[model samples]
Target: MPRLPAPLTLPPGHDAAGATGPDPAAARDRYRALRRRRRTETATAWAFVAPSVAVIVGLAILPVIWSLLLSFQADDLVTPSRWVGLDNYRALRQDPHFSQAVGNTLKYTAMYVPLSMLLGLGLALALNRKVRFVGLYRTLFFVPFVISATAQGVLFSFILDPQFGAANSVLHHLGISQQGFLTDPGQALLVLVAISLWSGTGFCMVVYLAALQDVPASLIEAARLDGAGRRHLLRHVVLPTLAPVNVFLLVWQLIESLQVFDLVYVTTKGGPLGSTTVVVYFVWQQAFQNFTAGYGAASAYVLAVALFVIAAGARALRRRDAGSPEGAAR
Candidate 1:
């Protein structure tokens, strides 16, 4: 090779070093400009968020606070309140109706949550295959979920009427005695559960379907290649992949079932000997029907506590799973 050219000299902004030095004043000015821009952005963000925060504090947060305080007092909507701390809670502890309502809510949640999830999962698994008219099928399945709970209750009530309803007519035609579907205290709760399942399973199905789509095809194929059967694949791969969604659906359905009111309101109205009187309906009865606002508030707080506990438990479960050995292996 020929002789190499000499290295270029640093012209300025250097202190015995080849590296070019930035101007101090210009750097400070740029820093100040960035800070100003950030401040402006933060202020604009807060401005946009202020309205929503105000609405939430006024409507949701304030009402929750008010209810907590109200739970300790004696008040009708028309009357001035008297502070009778803990009395409302104590009364609720001894109330047979309240006890029954709690039991009913638990019973409903126990049955509804698992059954609906199973039904939805089964439907999702079925619909995930390569089938014609899949979109139409999905739309049809989800239609009931979009219907209001009040509408579902009304529709079911008319269909299950003991006198001249379609259900009883079918029973009659099948040579069976006409059953008191909604009117029978023994059957009313069960009927409501069935109706609720009809309307809510679609929602569960949609969520599960979405989750199933996110399942890794590579993992599934690997499982199959490793001689895993369908059952094994579902147990070891599919269900595990949908774990978060499962937890979500479980908690959501648990809360929904516990707070069920619209169906009870429109259908049996907590009638047929209060067999279908869930906790929410019971609270409404106490607050609106009996004008025992404080007592109702106390009952509602009890429910709120239960929901908080459940949410906490779910979060703990998620954390534990994330820290688990199996999770690390995955």
Candidate 2:
């Protein structure tokens, strides 16, 4: 109390900001620091990702762009490529083998997508219960999916060989004629579909199983309480819950079916005739085997367009569904 000087007073936050605002110099320095920090962070992030970006561009993006260019040119890999503008694409329309390949590809996709999804869904439903060795059953089912494409082809080829296959041996034992499964052009495509279903259904089954885990048990119980039977519960409660996953599966399998090649490569090689000549196999046969690289590139581009369309459509549908009232309710 020895006559200390009075404390200087300012309005509420004015002590911190002065009468007008925070110190301009301080504010500018703070802004500069923030900008510097952000720049450093962005540079660091780019540095980390540059290698990956380079790899993707070098491998995937550049190849895609190159192939698109190749589609417009006639090149047999041996001769110098010539710019034919739309000739390669035009040739595709009149080329009988190309037409057959497209038809075969569409046929395979039509058969494979629905059948594989159906069988997979059934298996998934069956496996969605509490049972002994359920994990083992799931593992066995998924094993086929993990098997390499080459191995799958080899395994199936031996199993379905018209002459010395175990399947034929069984037919012989049963006193039935040994069917020309992979050998005959008529049965070859169908047989390929079966093999694909055998391998590809596992992936669908696993995806369905995972989706099933997310289905509302409460919804199921409520449906059952309200006089719902097995089919009704599935149709009304379970299936609706699974719509998004179903869309995903459909698009994914459609793309895969369109690009099917490896099994066709090893087993059929486009067939005894040209039966199993799917779009990808057709591309390989033309580009590498038949040495019509431009035509192959064109076919490949057609498939690429189809796949892009399907994926884009599915995405649009999903976005629309997500904006709907039902999606929000879910």
Identify the candidate with maximal TM-score.
2
| Reference-based TM-score, model 1 | 0.87
Candidate 2 CA-lDDT value: 0.91
Clashing pairs in 2: none
For each candidate, what TM-score against the reference?
0.87, 0.91
- lDDT tens per residue, model 2, 25-47: 87899999999999999999999
lDDT of 2 at 315: 88
Tens-place lDDT digits, model 1, residues 3-44: 999987777687676777888998999999999999999999
What is the model-wide C-alpha lDDT for candidate 1? 0.92
Model 2: what TM-score? 0.91
Number of clashes in model 2? 0
Off by over 4 Å in 1: 1-43
> Per-residue error at 50 for model 1, in Å?
2.5
